[model samples]
Target chain A: MKKICLGVVGIVLTFFSAYAQTPQKDSSTYKSRKLTFDEANLVSSYYKQEGNNAAVTGGIGSQKLSDISNTIDVKFIKWDRKDRKHSFDLEVGLDHYTSASSDQVDLKANSSASHADTRIFPSVSWLIENEKNGTTIGAGLSSSTEFDYQSIGANINFSKKTNNRNGEFTAKAQAFIDKVSLIYPTELRSGGGGDDDDDDDYATTARNSYSGSLSYSQIINQRLQIMFIADLISQKGLLSLPFYRVYFNDNSVQKENLPDTRMKIPLGFRANYFIGDKVILRSFYRYYHDDWGLTAHTVEVEAPVKVTPFFSITPFYRYYKQTAVDYFAPYKTHISSNQYYTSNFDLSAFNSNFYGAGIRLTPPKGVFGIQQLNMLELRYGHYTRTNGLNSDIVSMNLKFK
Target chain B: MKLVKLKPKVNRLAVVAVSAVAILSSCTTVKEYQKNKLNDGEMTLSSRKIQKTESSFQSYREGASGANGGKTGGGCGCN
Candidate 1:
């Protein structure tokens, strides 16, 4: 009986030794759960465009315009005890633009205060992801303010991944409450003499937009993936720019007018395929329709060729075509009989072509030997419309970690 | 002439749809280790970060908006 007890005790000791040899599931080795800085990015762009169609000037003036834009975004991340990941993104943007046609608002001033303007926008977003359930929820708030326009926006998003993690479905809802200051043309203003500094006399109108977007992305194979997106957007309130002048066939000029409510639907598809070890094809197509009798189709394709593991060059082209809205007419083409009329070429039937090339660098040692600078990208694009409009833009991006 | 011009687009769409279905139906359950290509930075199906401003300008300049992962409307592009 004594020998039997000793053997049992030995077995117990053996089991304890095995348990002690096994490594403990220590939480200390896990990633820190406290919020920490993840990365930051800066994007800058210069855009210039010139055309003969300027809506503000009865659609027959110089449409020369230039814009400089800059944006910065920072991201923070944390994890919770339940293994949920939380992320926060903060962004700020600035845009300064000059338009030659705006000077024609007064017709006598070579340069008017409205010729140049600056816009500032800021936004913040938060996302919480539960890895175990493959689901994420997010919310965001944003605002944009400029000389004549101000907007406040909010959005909420939710996404879920398939059981096998090969597919994801996302739904998002957004709303923007905006105010547009009515700055009618000098001749069209209530007062005979218009002063740019006098703002108390200007009236403000509300413009609101709401949209719901749904998308699904699936991995078709190891080297291919595809996504489908659809959006329903509705807008109410002032849809016309007060400064836009529409010339009637009878030589009468009036402020542009349009329906107070608009509804839009856009459907899109995107596909990306790894053609070879070093080349990838990305393609997108979209069909859009609106209540104002506008129908459009857009197609874009880009091919990125990897020069090295950390370097790539992409060339892209986009084709777009649209039918004119029912209320749209060219210069001095609309009749006084039409209740709603606009001379804005933007709403006219037209097609456009845009082509661009971009280069990206993600060096293993970081950009400029700075360990924190992760990547750099530069892109240039040229756009042309069938209606004698053309534009060029150059953009740069810097990513830091 | 318009119908002739549209014929190519319709055919292209049909071809794309067919190929997409075939590719999806023939998909094999890819293991995590085999996802390197799909996970490549350049393989993202969405617009690149460098294209942010491009998308914004396009939305302003073009009559049609949305479906490009860009804002449809809010800010005044009015110069």
Candidate 2:
């Protein structure tokens, strides 16, 4: 409610400011004098890739794994009479990573590393829309090579954008089905002394989730837009940590066993500011709490400043902190024989900070003798975790009409 | 009744059909829409950054054992 009021006040102030400032266009007023919705682009980039240090762990027995992935994607969009819409997006990609293991708690020491498999994944997307009535429906199917798993999802969205294209309401319901395929068994598992599934080849399970998304987007005049989104999600089936280990008496090791069902709801706010003709301000904040008795807060900020008309540099920063789940323990801290206990740092008490910058360059009109070169983006990221894991990533993307 | 079980699904289908129509309608003016756009040099979606920002969750990528879902592709030993 406060945000809505602020938006209204901002729009009113902007109107007054513009009305009072009787300005004449000098050097900058060269071409267009109006905003046309027809100039809007539906499909932008066809193929893109990005690499960012997705996670980090730094403490005892710590290991670091960073990713470098590249992808090729394409899209086909068509519009029938009466503004009906259909779009198909197909993407294929590969990923490679390096990892290290340690006997001690210090991730930096004895953290020797090894690289593994180049994976291929393909996905197909379908989208149907009716902009006039403010409704959208989308579904997708995708899979990975190594996991031999597939994801099937569908969503329905309802939105109302005001006549001025401001102050919009949107709600979405989505669901997904995921099949688990990743297997776990360290090299030493041949001894049959392994705590978890020494004789089991794989533990397969099906996971399903449903979510509701609600949002209000407002254009606070021409220079600013802000939106708030709330997401409620619930998932069930095999939520275990396949690779994480739990140490018990005499360093007895066990795989993580988690509850079959979990629930989470997150509320977030996003704001975008037209700081200048060539600079933009984007900021977001989210508060999340789950049924597992865990709470978390995340905040992020990004600024993109245009340079030379065809290139822009974006710098971003994020901070995240979460409290431990009820069944989390660092090592042997688990005393109860409960059905759910995990030593995974993902469930343990920890905080992390991610800071990075990226540069995007697009050819100006008529560059490279290509009439429809939409974009080219390059990005990199680095993340640091309290658990002694740090990683880096680099990626690139190309867009074409 | 079976009708009860089908209510949400049917409702979703209707919404999807409507939304699809909305999107298709958008394409009718693509040529016209291409004339007055900003970010014409290249396209940018501020929300897309959210996908990248989501990586900080740790659980999103680490837990999936490499589910590799969504727009971004990654290679990590989180599995």
Candidate 3:
């Protein structure tokens, strides 16, 4: 009986010790309160266009232009004491372009200083999201600067999710204050002679814009989602480019003129659907109208086919049509009696088609075997307008984590 | 004659309204666990980052803008 008792005691001790050594369940969820690095994206694009409708030259000159643009954005995230997530995004963009039409601003000079310019834009945004409440608030400030134009922009946005997390509503307000240099065509300049390179020598005019937007997104099912968006935009102050020449029926040339105030409304819808296991279809439609007597319609569609777990190809097409604004006319088609006149073809009635294809690669090991490189995408598009304008653009994006 | 002219427009609008209602009514509540396909990057309802420049140029080249998460009227695109 003594031996049996000892054996039982040993067994009980072993069981107790094993049980005690087993790791206890952690009842508290751990979240890092410190700010953490999230991800970064680098985007680059090259665009070139050729046509004969140059607004600067009274809509009848070389409209060739080429631009190279690059932008980088970095993001960081942190959790506050209230368990709300805060995210910060900083982005900077640069663009350099050479336009054959801008050279005509001098009219008498070849390859003038106005032919090439560079622009830099930078923005910073902060967002706070409450997971428990499924709400987010964000604000951002942005600025853009070039030789003849400067713009400052600000925006605030808020979003809330439905109880079931299947739908979300978002609202945003934005404002921009801009300054445009009153640089006129050489022949039309009152003084007839000024240093083209001295941007400060010219007078500047203010142009301000404000807009309010609302959007709602709903998940139709496990494989499909849709969104509806609408915006009201208002602009006041200088609305026309001073360098854009307008030639009247009598062949008299003057600077383009437009109303000082404009209002616009745009309504849009987007739908995305996943088909089977390998394809996704995305579609968008927009209807736009403005007090300037311009009405437009846009439709876009894209299909992405997944060839592998890590690779996909997307093909897209877009159709856009717009009616001429009240102030718009072709070269030498305007009458001097009109209060507002412009020869800018962009404001004239036209239709355009844009088509493109893109490839994306996201390997498990990372793109190009670099663990930090999360994805790489390359895309090319061709755009053609019915009024004899054609352009091509190539874009690339790289994401790092 | 005027009524006949307006009849087609009314029919078109009615068809659009009915289609939208049908689509919305068919929506099913999807749980988070069943959102694998919905979570795909390509399934996003917004414009892709790669289309930023495209959107910029379009806003400049075309008279119509806004409602696409892009700048409506800010900087001068006079080039």
Q: Judging by TM-score against the true structure, name the best candidate.
A: 3
**Candidate 2 local lDDT, residue A142:** 60
- 1 or 2, greater by TM-score: 1
Model 1 spans > 4 angstroms off: A1-29, A192-195, B1-23
Residue B45, candidate 2: Cα error in Å is 6.4
Interface RMSD in Å per candidate, to 1 decimal? Answer: 1.2, 8.8, 0.7
Q: Which parts of model 3 are misplaced by more than 4 Å?
A: A1-30, A192-197, B1-14
lDDT of 2 by residue, A1-401 (tens): 23533453354334334433333222333322231111111111111112222112211343444444444455655665666566667665555444443212122345322223345556676776677765566766665554324455555656676554445677777676766544433532443322332323444567677777787765543455566677778787766644456665456655667788988777776767666577778787777778887787777788878886777898989777878788776666665566777766665565767777767656755225443444656666666666555555554454444
Ranking by TM-score: 3, 1, 2
* Candidate 1 positional error at B21, Å: 4.7
Give candidate 2 misplaced runs (Cα > 4 Å).
A1-62, A101-115, A148-150, A182-203, A366-372, B1-46, B49-78
| Cα displacement (Å) at residue A233, model 1 | 0.5
| lDDT sort, best first | 3, 1, 2
Q: Candidate 1: how large is its RMSD?
A: 13.9
Winner by lDDT between candidate 3 and candidate 1? 3
Candidate 1 chain A weakest lDDT stretch, 10 residues: A17-26
Chain B TM-score (model 2 vs. true structure): 0.43
Best by lDDT: 3
Candidates 1 and 3: which is better by TM-score?
Answer: 3
